[model samples]
Target: MSTQQSNRVTAVYRTTTLLAYQGNPLIEALPPLNSFIEDLSALRGSLKCTPEEIHLNGVERAHSICRVIDDFFQPLSQHIQLHERISLMIRGGYVGRNPDTGDWARHIQNGYERVLSGDLKAIKFTEVNSTAQSMTLIGCSGNGKTTAMKQLLSLYPQVIYHPNMNLEQVVYLKIDCSHDGSLKEICQNFFRAMDRALETSNYEKQYSMRKRLSIETLLAAMAQVANAHALGVLIIDEIQHLSRSRSGGSEKMLNFFVTLVNTIGLPVILVGTPRARKIFEADMRSARRGSGLGALFWDPMDEGREWKALTDKLWSLQWLQKRDEVLSGEIRALWYDLSQGVLDIVVKLFVLCQLRAIATKVERITPKLMKQVYEDELRPVHPMLAALRSDDPEEIIKFSDLKLSDTDKRLLELQQRVALSTQQTPEEFAYQQLRTDEERRVYMALKDDFNSKLLAPIIRQIFDQNPSLTWIRLLPLVHEYLNNPELSKPKDNPKKPKSTGRKASVKQTEWHTLDSDDLRFIYSQTDSNSEIYPAISKSGLVLNIQSLLEEAS
Candidate 1:
């Protein structure tokens, strides 16, 4: 038999032996979930601006807020699902196996020989069966699809060297579909990406620079390079750019993707805004092929659990002078109305409102203030937001992809204005003077000394009571209160306790001694018509300790 035929026989023999020896031959090859999560968990981004940072002037504050915006990410249910889906795709796609054709053994054997020979063109293989899958993620702009994917993919090492196989495996490759949408350009892009990843300009020089090369020739080169590197997945972002009028058409572009999966056995993930939906809808075969892992259509967040969770977390990051930490119903309602639950709008509106609050010295984010910000600062996005608010699918689609160019420009202007104005504000200058390092140290120390929840309001009250006193001068009074806790407590007439028949206020104690009935009564008082007992019972609240202990038995 020839070398290729001989290798095929060897592969079959090894496969049979492995199957007989082990119940599951591919079990050891699967990527470990624990390791993936451990690696991924570290990749999550976070931003927290302290009180001092919040107190900074406009330009500084704007810069800091922008950083927060850039760093902020709240992983939702869809994020978890997307991560798992991609992981599954990678695991299935990179298993180097196809039970239908029994090609796994041949692939492994050929790959080893190719590595040993150190000849890129020596390996000869046929595409009989492919186990590659494709996934399409369609979402509105700024829904965090790209950001989440970047973070998720960052967990995996870009280039993994399998010492035993002597192979360099690229776990994933991401490329943006150019505006031209030319197949030739895409093929060149693929080569350039590979060149960057491998630290070699061979492909770029060999394929891309050659103007005479046919699209087909470039595509063949791309397939060879992809298989040579053992590419795990190919992610094409901004797929909407593949306009039929500009490129050979969406059909041709999609055909290329199908070819990749069917022949090269490389999984693909296409990510784009809602505009790309037209491309997939144009060809049923392409749509069906792309839905191998199922299509994930991410709409704007509804006023549901995910929306509440996202807003609640973002609300907690407030650094305003008048901190409305509680997410009031009115504020939430106004927020949803203004943003229509689009995450990008929600975050931008929040940052702009904070800036407005600081600029106007209102120092709080109220319903009126939020509305004013949305009307004045976010006028550029008003049309898009209105379309979303209309709940008309066609209207939404028309406006969904609208870029926020004007609004962004306006925000920059606002930042500059705030920075300039902050310097001239006498109160800000006075506040800045009082904010010495020692004063901050004392404030932080006292914050730790007292209940963190109570300290801010107490300090605000102290400042308000003695407006003339500088922060440094006020430090002694704060220390005195801390040193003598009894002096800080409100004095009550000694005879009043004897005169009143009722017990001290329930708020006085921290609920350590409150009975279940008393807690239920308090809960009922908070919402008079609501059934507290049933809710408490559903929550597994037990009135009696001995009864609960007996139930555990």
Candidate 2:
């Protein structure tokens, strides 16, 4: 369940250029700091789709290509700043806690004393002042805060093995604040995360599994584990959830996070939505500690060079039969209007438009189709998008971060069902019918080319629509329908029976939703935004190259 993977690398310590970073095994084992351009190039996502792959004649393949966009990250200025800040924080924190010296051992001893005494202040026994600092990154839900963090973290090994000292140097560990924002849950997750990184059940068994352990005892244990492993940095995401913390639980968590930096010599990065700003603002001491490395507020992307660069790159991945060689200004403006510059919405909008274009046989993205997709599929976020558009402080405050909750997923499902109901084709009407032998023969022949379940409806509809046509003549039409499903759109059926139940009265069209296998659904289920594509890929949503080749053969 842990999102981060450990790269158990042998310690390859280099002489660091910076004086403060020099002579520390923890700092020296890291990949050497690079220039801005080098970092940018390294951080940019490498996943790409070719034109041949895009134009592949299969709905499933098309969906897989669309899902690929989830992995398409282009580092911007904000990412560079974050990279530098985190890079500095981790190495700087390690400067004072050299494992070669007695400093690290002493720190561990102090932490064990704290754990034994059930006192957070017991770590103050050491004369070595922590060089560690904490940072806060606040952004809108879909603006790529967690994504950037994860990508940057990928530069360093999550777990490093030092054979000389028999140390498992955990470079970093990230955990989410629980939905209820319980400090106890956070402590348990920390232990679990550390256990995962270190490949040991000792920490989890010793601390987290004990139900009767006081929060103070748990905090002491958590801090001790962090020091015992020489944890480089700690990242706590969804800090906005701390708003749900009851009876000053939020304050206690904040104070403990500060102690991790000040006492344990571990840098901390707190990532959250705009709503979390109020928590920091309430306490001056916590505010100062939280922003020791300067807090970053990530607004939704604007229509600037970064936006153009991202869209231009994304626009090039069209799998439509009629690929638009160039992105036009009209469609670009419409995209911004609909997504309001949220990175997730922006990418999903592009993806859904392509899927819709393939379904409707438009073959190219247009402003009208984009708008229609937005209206039909993305209605759940309309209010949030509207709030962003208004740019009014009061209006924005009324909405929560646009994380797709269970309710939102239900809304997407209902919306999709309604869309399917209203847009029912002739194929749908004749789907179950296979009354004649000729229809059965046609089904047997085409089932090999297409999915059996999907081909049934197309074959049935062809026979019903052209009753006089032979099975020989119907083959071309069936293939055509497979390519363009909208070719046989049904006319209004006034004679059709109407629903009498309460379900009929329910306004289903207003309920917006997405499907279970949709990338958005994968995103919702995932813990880290950075891991969305990996999760989707593992879900069998992305097209497999070997399978494609085998099918072609």
Candidate 3:
């Protein structure tokens, strides 16, 4: 049958069928677990900063350290499992028979119709059936579940286009559950996310704006859109918002999730705090249907190997004047006690302590200093940290409800000031003075070779001697001075080359392997140095060739 005719038949069958169509098994599309683990293990992110980059003064160092939080992600075992589960869900959800080469739609329609007619006994054994998989991520506040999910999802493209199949596949869509927990609002969020992903406002414009639309109609429309776009996975963040009292009660919301999985064949991942446990417990069958890949409960890092590893890695990123090479027993114990092994609290505590250390000019981190900072700078989170230390679940939840607005605001202000300060040119700073563009350029070129303090005086001396020299003419002179400081001063007896034998014979074999400095010396003897040096340097053959020649020789 033609593609157009097949789609029409399938649509008609879908309307009459009671049972949803399950696509072909997705096992073939999924990589082996080992391969998946390897791919996930290879994922890493860190702020790119060298020692030179971190050589900022006190205030600059504090701000730079704060900025590291933006990219700091330490992978753990939960991260590996999260990657594997999500990868499977995405691969499985996208696995339908090839639209270009197979009559898969016909098979789906037949199976769906037969199952709907209550004639499962009559259905053939040859039919393929598969459903979407799901996983739940439950964690306490600031346990890094949300951050981990985002990092892993970032590895896949948001949209994939298959030209042969004429399909635009959405790899993943993350929607924040509405604070009110209404299914209608969740549907609208889905439409908005779709519009954002596809860069088309059609869905939101058409369906989301229709206030009269019922939850069932909205869900049906969402499923249709999901299938049409071949959505791989749907992530609902802040799922704890779907409380029974807030989101039309638990039963309705639970059924909605079931429908999403069974009807649309779209994998759904629910990420929320411990409060979400009540929702799952309210409906065990619905929870089972939603979580095919099992749930990951992320708690605070224990004071074990993982905690030590994380703290040790983060400890190395300190920008203090006095490097804490060895994490002292007192400091380590105090750190775990103060932060309670919570990743977010641990990092913030570290940052705040660094700032305090700098402001006080103590120039080093210590147990006593950390305690003082905790009491002074981290007052907002003290209760939560205390509750965690107490090991009281109810008290912990209650205290954790507090947000670090004051601390975060201070950090942001510091970051902004640092950003503005760093934006100024080296000449703008009070400590360094460059009187002219020529001086600045020459200093910059040789800054890597010599200390800025040492190089500045030399640059000033060269410019003072030749006030009329252009930058281009001054560059060669600067290079000469760098090669020999005595060349900058007056040379009474400049050595001239002695013609050993009228001239040395040029050998083709030796010429090819000669260093640029040697080549320049030979070219100058032959009166071609000026012509050759610029071309050789511009072509990048002169800069790094000396090491190779030295090694070969």
Candidate 4:
């Protein structure tokens, strides 16, 4: 019973701590912060259990409350950081687990948003409808900003969302702002997003709207459709793209965004990285007057007393789930030593350690397992971690300025190398077996050292054979002959290995389609909308009769 009570007091400490660090900076492991956590662990370690002593207050209860007073209240009495810690935690103190839903972390963030709404329904009391509203979801990289917004979008779409009551005339659209700089490109992507939404909405009554719509007709049609269906929310994601500017282009895009809210009266929700706060502040200068777009401060966990608070919250969260889960004060001390209580590091360490424990069939999370996960899973993050570890103001800005999201950017070039390595030739396997990523990098560099004698014969042979056709196809034929064919046996022109295996006879039809400059999209290089149109639209009775009259003429 004494042991259980000790655990409860420890639980309270963590619950209190994590609540403090939620939207704060990544805390450090220096003096007071580390000492505070250590002192609490020491207090728990020193607690003595007694079955006797006719005292009114339980011994365990006294120890628990004293630990809080000594480790928290007393130490915090002289520090301003501690005061800030208490304030933020108190702000979110009411956001407990929902009785029915029981989702804790998400519910609290939801509660934070609800505070603005001034109602239990979690809709802002202000003009949630009939007004231009935007939210700056501010966070640096690895803070789960994008993932949180995606989750919010998913959750909000499923809920009973509205301004006052009218739900019939509502439409919702979500678009990533990185689509392009031009207003036309942004509008074009808007239509594309709307087109997908219409396909998903799948309302049969809107069939005519869908049928009459081409991609180009999407924006004007959506504005009309919103009036008809009542478009309520428009979510513009990745507003940091405005920082990714081209002269006055971002201003133009911002103007179009303003036009959507001001002219169309559609409620806009802008989600962006920390840099987007600059764009919003800039916009509030001239044209964007009276815009009620508030910023949601999603700061990362800060250091000092806040770190201990964050660690405690994260620990208690687990304790609530499994009282018998082996992590005591000893484990929490070890965890804070390695991870610094940055939520990403803390969360990822858990995931990796869970996998590690399960792989080794261990019953509990181990400090050794934590070390291994840190080396393997968390070491790659050391560069960014080192940057965060610095105290320079410039370093802070550099860390905050996520030029491209390191987490979201595709490692496709590496993947393509792996894919190519999977399909290696016998010559490649014999000569080159790249054992590491760096080894492979070196191998690619030395590839240009090849003699022309290796290639000259191949080119000579290709030109010797299919003079009428392109060398692109002929080179592959030559490669096939050399790799898999028999030169001595006249093996049915084994140069054409695919043809040698099987032959099919079929008539070929010449294909022709006229294309304008706008009909192309080369991904990274091109921005113009596709100008191509198919010949299958309704001229109805008028277009047919006009065609007939033209024929009569």
**Which candidate number maximizes TM-score?**
2
lDDT-based ranking: 2, 1, 3, 4
Q: Point out where model 2 deviates above 4 Å.
A: 1-6, 243-250, 405-553
How accurate locally is residue 342 in candidate 4, as Cα lDDT from 0 to 100? 48
Per-residue lDDT of candidate 3, residues 1-553 (tens digit): 1010110111111111112223322222222323434554345555544577445665568767887566777888768778778877876655543233242353344345443453322233344344577788887777787778877776666666555445566768999986656778888999999999888899999899998976666776776677666677999998887757755777878777866665445689989877787888887777776667888988788888888888787788778655567786668889988888777778888887777655544446766578877787778888877888788989866754355678787666645554554455454442234545567778777777766655776777666666555555566666677678656473322442332332223344333222333553334323244666665564355667778899999
Per-candidate TM-score against the hidden true structure = 0.68, 0.73, 0.65, 0.41
Answer with 2 or 3, whichever has the higher lDDT: 2
Model 2, 1-553: lDDT tens per residue? 1122337788888887788777788888877777556666666667766766764443443555455445778878878788788888888888879977778888988998898899998854558678898999988777888878888898778988888888889998999987756777888999889888777888889888889999889888888888988989999999888643462555666687788888888899989887888778877876776678888988899899988998998887777656567887867888998998998788877877776665554556766578888888788788888999999866776664767454335334543543453354434323323445677677767765776667876777776676655666666677778877776544433443343321111122211122334455446444576877887787678889998899999
Specify the poorest-scoring 10-residue window by lDDT in model 3: 1-10
Candidates 1 and 4 compared: the better one by TM-score is 1
Candidate 2 backbone collisions, by pair: 411-512, 412-512, 412-513, 412-514, 413-513
| Cα RMSD for candidates in order | 12.7, 14.3, 17.2, 30.1
Q: Model 4, range 1-553, lDDT digits (tens) per residue?
A: 1110110010111122554333221110101223323333321323222323212122222223223212221122222322233222222221221112332234334334433443333422233222334334555565545544332232112112222322222224667766334333444456665546544444323433355544223344444443333344666676666533552544545554554454444556676655666565665553354243544555455545756655554333221111223345645776755654445565555544543332232313544456766776566565555666664545644556444233212222322333444345533642332222332333343335443234333444444344443434454454554555455221234454242322211112101111111121111112233412221121121246777889999
Native-structure RMSD, model 1 = 12.7
Superposed on all Cα atoms, model 3 deviates from the true structure by an RMSD in Å of 17.2
In order, the Cα lDDT scores of the candidates are 0.66, 0.74, 0.65, 0.39
| Ranking, TM-score, top scorer first | 2, 1, 3, 4
